[model samples]
Target: MRLFVGGLPPDITKRDVEGRFAPFGAVAGCDIVPSKGLGASPGECRGFAYVDFEPKDNASLARCLSL
Candidate 1:
């Protein structure tokens, strides 16, 4: 399952997101949405991200905690 994490701090990184959700379950992948417009770096996030998990159950648990 793919989970959308929004309102993330500008300084947040992919490793940070993985670490936070690691306790919940294995993270298949994580991608922070890049900021748009002039002077935006690839490493910069648009205050949001998408985290992928193997099983739906783990994703569901993470979702609950996020809320």
Candidate 2:
């Protein structure tokens, strides 16, 4: 299952996201959206990201995440 994680710091990195969610379940992938404004820095994140988890671990991990 895929989850949307928002409100992250603009400089957040892929490794940072993966580390946080690693304990929850197996993260299949993590993509941090990049900023696109005129003054946005290179490699700066857009303060949001998508986290992909294995289907088998989705339900239980989702429950824990909600709490």
Give the whole-model CA lDDT for all candidates, comma-separated. Answer: 0.84, 0.94
Candidate 2 matches the true fold with a TM-score of 0.91
Q: What digit string (tens of lDDT, one per residue) describes model 1 on residues 1-67?
A: 7889899987789999999987777788999998998887767889999988878567466677799
- Name model 1 segments beyond 4 Å from true: 56-67
Q: Name the top lDDT candidate.
A: 2
Candidate 1 pairs with clashing backbones: none
Q: How many residue pairs clash per model? A: 0, 0
Candidate 2 error regions (>4 Å): none
TM-score, candidate number 1: 0.76
Report how far off residue 32 is in candidate 1 (Å): 0.7
Candidate RMSDs in order = 2.8, 1.1
Backbone clashes, candidate 1: 0
Question: Candidate 1: deviation at residue 9, Å?
Answer: 1.4
